[model samples]
Structures are given as C-alpha cells and as structure tokens.
Target: MARVIFLLVAVVSVFQALAAPLHSRAVTSPQCSQFNVYASAAIDEARLSLGSINTGNDIGNARNILQAQLSLLDANTGVTEIADSLLTSAPPAPANASATVVAGLQAALASLNQIFFLADNTTKAAVAAANASMITALDNAQQAVAANCQTTLN
Candidate 1:
C-alpha cells in the first residue's frame, strides 16, 4: 500500500509539471503582448481612415490618414519582427503564431501599397472600393494574430 501511494503521488506530480507549462504558455510573452497592442492600434487607425474615405468626406485628408497608417504599419512590422525573433526560441505555438503575424503584416502592407498609389483624381466609388480592400486585409491580420497568438486586443 505504501509503494502504491508513492507511485500515485509521483504520477500526479509528473502530470502537474507537464500541465503547468501548457497553461502558462497561454499567456503571451511581453514582447508578443506589446506587438498585440501596437498592431491593434494600427488596425484601428487604418479602419478609421478607410471609413473616412468610404464616407466621401475629406477625401484629400484621407491621404494624410493613409500616410499616417502606412507609417504605423511600418513601425508595427518592426515590432513584430522583434517579437518573432524572440519567439523563435519559445515553444512551437508562439513561434508559429509569430510567423502568422508576420504574414498578416506583409499582406496589410501590400494592400496599403496599392491603396496609396490611387490617383488623387480617382472617383469616390473607386477609392471606397480600395478602402474596403485595405480594411479587409487589416481585419484579417488582426484576426489571425488574435486567433493564433491567443492575444487579447486592448
């Protein structure tokens, strides 16, 4: 009976040890958390700017907004790159999530690049269409990061 009890306690201890890391990994690292915050803010800004374009108000001002969002996207890419590097040594889940974030950022950047090239004389409908595409790309990036990284938007 003593040997059985000891074996049971040892097994329980092992299980607890195995479970701890899994639970802890659910919370992202500080770098990843920072990336989440920055990325979320960038996405929000992009959406707001795009909405302005869609509403046909301040079309000229929308260019400035897009430029600002472009800058934020560039900055976010740098932040996520750092997070990705740090996460490389982390567990597979976080590392994969970081990769997803990188891909998403790239997509958003590409979409923004296209939107930025729109001629100043472009029709409102055309501009609105482009804005919609950009918004979709941004939304996808946000969703991918939240789903893959287990990141909570602030």
Candidate 2:
C-alpha cells in the first residue's frame, strides 16, 4: 500500500510540474505585454491623425497628419521587434504566422513610403487609402501576435 501511495504521489508531481509552465507564462511574458501596449498606442495615434487628415483640411494640415502617422508607425518598430522575438522564441502552430506578421509590417512600410510622394488632391486620396491599408495591416499583425503568442491586450 505504501508503494502504491508513493507511485501516485510521483505521478501527481509530474503532472503538476507539466502544468506549472502554462500557469506561469501569462505572468512572465513581459515583452509581449509591452508590445501590446506600444501597438495600441501607435494605433490610437494613427487613428487620431487619420481623423484630422479626413476632415477636408488644407493640404498642409493633411500632410502634417500623415507625417505624424508615419512617425508613429516608425516608432512602432521596437514593439514589432518584441512581438517578433516572442514569436521566434515559441513559434506558433502554423509556421506561416510569422510570415503573415512580416507581410503586414512590410505593407505598412510600403504605404508610408508612398505617402511621402503625395503631390496633389488625387495623390492625397491615394495616400489616405494607403494609410487605411497600413492600419489594417498593423492591426492584423497585432491580432496574429495576440492569437499565436498567447498575448493579452490590456
């Protein structure tokens, strides 16, 4: 009877050890948490700037808003890096998830590059569309990270 009890205890200990990591990960994923915060802030800034740009404002005002958004997107690079690190450390089940995130980041950067070439109202409209595309790409990337990395957006 004592041998049986000892075996049971050992089995229970093994199970507990296996479960502990999952429980601890949420509390320990600081880089993912930081990434979420930075991503949210950058998204908020982009939204506000996009609002200003869409107000039928003067070209200069629109340009200024776009420039601000570009800066925000640029600043989000660090956060993206953190997200990348987390993903790399523990790749998602779907191996292509990291590639999706990369594609999104590239799309945002491409849109930003195109924005700087705006020369007329038509071009401004195109820039606006590109900005919208960038936001969608960034948001998609964030969602992918949250889903695959077990990240909580708070």
Name the candidate that leads on TM-score: 1
TM accuracy, model 1: 0.36
lDDT of 2 by residue, 1-154 (tens): 9999999999999999987844211122555455455454545545454554552544544555555455555535534554554445533223343344445455455545544444557546645664664565466556646555443222
| lDDT at residue 80 of model 1 (Cα atoms) | 53
**Residue 154 CA displacement from its true place in model 2, Å:** 17
Q: Provide the TM-score for each candidate, comma-separated.
A: 0.36, 0.33
Instruction: Report every candidate's CA lDDT.
Output: 0.51, 0.51
lDDT of 1 by residue, 119-142 (tens): 445434544644464455445445
Worst 10 residues of 1 by lDDT: 89-98
Clashing pairs in 1: none
Q: Which residue pairs collide in model 2, if any?
A: none
| Model 2 segments more than 4 A misplaced | 1-28, 55-102, 116-148, 151-154
Error of 2 at 68 (Å): 13
